[model samples]
Target: MSNNVLFDVPGPRARRTSRIASIVTSVVIVGGLFYLYLALEAPRVTANGTETPGMFDPTRWDVITDGRMWNAILVRGLLLGTLKMAAVAAVFALLIGVIFSFARTARSKWIRIPAAVLLDFFRGMPVLLLMLFILLIIGPGAYWAGVAGLAIYNGAVIGEALRSGIQSLPKGQRESGLAIGLTPVQTRLIVEFPQAFRQMLPIIIAQLVVLLKDTSLAYIIAYPELLNIGLRQLPTTYGNRYFFTFFFIVLIVYLTVNLLLSWVARIVARRTASGRKTRRTGPTAGKDEKVGVDTAAMNAVMPDSS
Candidate 1:
């Protein structure tokens, strides 16, 4: 009945319904996970006289009488390769982002538009197709094709991400730096980028989430990332265990990485906010000012005061 629309509240029955829905959702999610676990260990039947169970067995982990396929495929093959590729990608993307972000935000028309066009050309291109093209041109190898592909596309996107963050900073910050007689580049490097980077931490993390998932595409070019490894270990009887392998390895990694990043971002944001509070409380509160007022000189100064 209140005039303010914000006063609207849910009734008791609605709260009960919400709780009921939450319980149902939780049950479904748990059940799905359990079912997938069962499917992963669902007995791999082979052709002719040989039978290889295509699943990870926890209880009999030591009894790997055959090949350590899980170790080969999932560990040394996919997991390590992914981490390596992602690390390389992050560094390259960071470099690209810095260059593009600076160029885009620069006052020079000649630099900004052209740089923008180049970034757009790369970013707009399909990630998978672009990687494949590079693979064909550059020849196949983990570092050459796999990591290179990750770097090219991710870096292009990261460049734009950085530029967006820089743009979102308060306009007054840049203007103030300029008004204080700082040069354009000085203003950006010293004032704009630091604050902007802090504020854009959240979005940068979100982009990382995208980067994490895109690693799966490496499988297409035989890059032997986690998914690629998982596929190789697929049971003949369980041909479409992609749902399990991918969900367990890929999505698990994605969620875990994103969550960890989010936690780090939250900590950084809290620290940044605390820093702002301290700055606002009084930047010069601690130091004693050196007032060089000699007593003898003060007597002479008092005579001149009249």
Candidate 2:
């Protein structure tokens, strides 16, 4: 049996139990899905005394084959509404994250304390409630309300992640910056922030994914985002018979976009890691020189120490 550090390696009996559990869970899930399929295939009747086709019926999904429907849902709803809002919110969130991260990491207690309190407040507030609050104040503009809410909340989250990344670095990194005759602010800006951002990139991307999905919440404020268009507008424009079809499409779009973001994050992280490894072990591996920090630049700006 192989040993493991995180937990004990399963013995024969434990392995058997695990297999049994896995089989049982799989059976339950398949059975549930089968039941749902049958339910959808069953016939339904409408209030107008007319028989309606089941969800699985081919005719009910024919709307998806229409070009106009695609244009309305994909282009207008998804591109113009959801993606646009997410893109804008993401930019603002990143800017806010940088500002808050700096304030949180500042030497002054006055600045750091207030930033901490504001960060906590934003992080603690529910996203939907925040949107609603913004909606009330903004008065009928769901887009800006949703954007502001998402930016503020996700900004606070990203800020904390960045701060943690910076703090997790070895003390020698900061000391080396100081030894090179760099001011604390200059060192932090030039040396520490870039490394911290790279370290925390995965977390930041994950939060942005969350922000993208949260755009659906704007539906509550009457914004014509993906969910709103699919659920309300399309059903009314075409017919309620295609509700599940629209819903399935919306779900798939959300999943696809988020998965793409996760994939991009993985690729970026891998490249950054490889670049760092190369810097440490390239042709100058044994040279007594700083691999990343530019000491000469710091010295040029500082007074010569006799």
Best by TM-score: 2
After superposition, which runs of candidate 2 have C-alpha atoms over 4 Å from their true positions? 1-28, 45-49, 272-306
lDDT of 1 by residue, 60-149 (tens): 333233356557545765568676677777777677777888988778899999988988787767777778777787776645675666
Candidate 1: residue 281 Cα off by (Å): 8.9
Candidate 2: the clashing residue pairs are none
Error of 1 at 4 (Å): 13
What is candidate 1's TM-score against the reference? 0.65
Q: How far is 57's C-alpha from truth in model 2 (Å)?
A: 1.6
Q: What local lDDT score does residue 64 receive in model 1, on the 0 to 100 scale?
A: 31
Cα lDDT tens digits for candidate 2, 178-289: 9999999999998889988886675677778788888888999888998899889999999888889999998898889888988987887687668767878877565554
In model 2, how many backbone clashes occur? 0
